[model samples]
Target: MNATQEKHIAVVGGTFDPIHYGHINLGRAALSALHLDEVWFMPSGSNNYRSDMGIRAEKHHREAMVKMAIAGEERFAFSDWECAQPGSTYTSRTFAQLNATFPEVTWYYVVGADTLHSLKYWEEPELICNSVVLLAAGRGEQVTSGELQATAQTLRTNYGADIRFIPWEDMPVSSTQVRARYREGSFAREDLPPGVYDYMTSHHLYQSLEWLSDQEILDRCDATPEERGYYERLATMLTPRRLRHCLGVMHMAMLLADGYRNVSMEQARLAGLLHDCGRTENNALNALGHAPAGAQVARRLFGVKDESVLSAIRWHTTGRPGMTELEKVIFVADYIEPFRGHMLHLDKARRIAYTDLNQAVTFMGESTVRYLESRGEDIDPITLETVNYYRGLLKKQPIPGQYQ
Candidate 1:
């Protein structure tokens, strides 16, 4: 169907916190079934009531996600009409605006099965009923198909609304489930639409304290029940983006710990997870970087009694002269975690890390020293001293049981 020749169109509106395949599928089904000339992914939500509420992503972000989700689909378009509007929005007013603005087009408002049953109770049901046709995605979990058809008939009789159901067996994904998985640090690459996960990771969309109560956070730590509060506090301290990085480091540290005899997984897990606890919006504007401050915070506020864990967190940013194996694990993991795409020597260090611990630290130190020199930046004396120590240590002998 040509856009210029179009007479029929569908508007799929919701919060679309991070539009996923389920939403894309709904639009696709609408275009195919209704022979729609165009399907607009118009995000509609009131600032008054929201599923994610205050922590719900910014409207621009929601709009960007909708735009990204519908890209390359000729019939699928993104609409910022309602989302860009100021203040609370009612569906009736929104559709009325569309009708008045583009009277040539016949509009079909797309919604889920749950919304299908509640159409009349919405503000100005007659205006909504008279303005557009209703096309509901068939989410038949809580409510049955017979119930949806019955509700559709009731709406038609009472409000003179035209409601149609698309055949959706079940909605495989929901924003709540997606947010839960993100909070747990367990969402897979396939769980979201393309670019959505990367966008979420970049923006730190769902890593909030509110996203998890959080048993999910406790489970994600892979820690004991006693350590739950520490992880919870950690979640609250860092920004959402930083919290994700911490989880990545914690997971990577655990992976690296498996290869070394001296390193304990529990110790590595705790150290990696809390390595950045001192980070905040202000710490002398990052003049007091996280490493040393983190150790102090770990001991005082979090009550981490383990000196090994404290030492690991302390020197993670600046490698020390006589660093322990666990220290190297946290340091290496922080630098080489999977989420880091911007740092130097990441792939080489990551490869060498699993093979030889001593050589990995040596590589990390030497490369950082060189990068700092090339940039004409003031090299930290401790960093130079630590690099020298690792170089000399590499010459002397390899530590026992340090090889993968």
Candidate 2:
């Protein structure tokens, strides 16, 4: 690399709630795919959500934790960008600040495969893409070139930017799973990255009362037994009808993800199984939203922090204008679950998953939009956007036949 000319810079930011191997793999992949000079591991601080939690460690403590986690990595360096910002930080702002500091360096914002799908929905997502290349890690059945092309077209048409999709097939481990295990008091040192494992053990992270909430839930679920024989028994005990809705959404969402050719079966299944866990009270469906509830459950019970999965569950019921494939999968699956009542076209929609997940998901989205329209329900912005997003793709590359 020339000394005078700036090198490519890839920024990988996360809560590091206890960074793990997956994070390291993502950082390394970004460097190779973006052809960058270095990758920065940025830790967040005092954001709107974290600030409210009152559980995030002090700035120095968190930074020290990050330092400990990345001690031996030569290619990875820590940047306190989110921590330095005065308020809740956004990706666009972070990219701009980093670019201003190193104007000559080409920038790429590294995100998981799920986050990349939902990038269009982020605040000022267009500018963020324009400012830095968007790199994604992992694969599932859901991602397809058509989907990427659709997302690219949306960015170009709406934001005047193009994003490069780097398919990453790295480790499948998730921070959320780690968190869930931690919450349940079952997480071991083996679950973390070598460096992170060392840091957690030395400092004793995730062993507090705050994280033990899920243990109580696990206890309750284990205690309860449903009367239904097998599937019913599993559904009622492992995943309830209401929870089944979330899982069905997840199952369909995974198929949708498969259509995109990026979502993995394993990741989707896990997301499906855990998506509706936050919805504790079935009767309170219209009252307390499920995402926050599910997210709380995930953090306490399941330990999910993939952000993509968390965001999917959080926004499933009231989808915003733009969502990733994973998010759409969870959202649409809830409505189209095989066991759910009052489905618009359950057979048609369900069949689409086996043939063309995109078609199925688009059908689910359109049906959902129409269903809500008929009932005068408040339509989720993202649900509409997801419909439109697919409609745009369907126009560009129509499916062969009506999904069987």
Taking all chains together, each candidate's TM-score versus the true structure is 0.49, 0.47
Candidate 2 per-residue lDDT, tens place, 225-320, comes to 211121232354343446445434443444344333456544555566566666554426552366667766666655566777777667666554
Give me the overall lDDT of model 2: 0.59
Candidate No. with top TM-score = 1
Tens-place lDDT per residue, model 1, 18-113, is 788878888887887788889999886443112111245545556677887788988988887775554357889998999898878999987777
For lDDT, the strongest prediction is 1
Q: So what's the TM-score on candidate 2?
A: 0.47
Give lDDT: candidate 2, residue 96: 85
Pairs that collide in candidate 1 are: none
| CA lDDT of every candidate | 0.73, 0.59
User: What lDDT is reached at residue 182 by model 1?
Assistant: 80
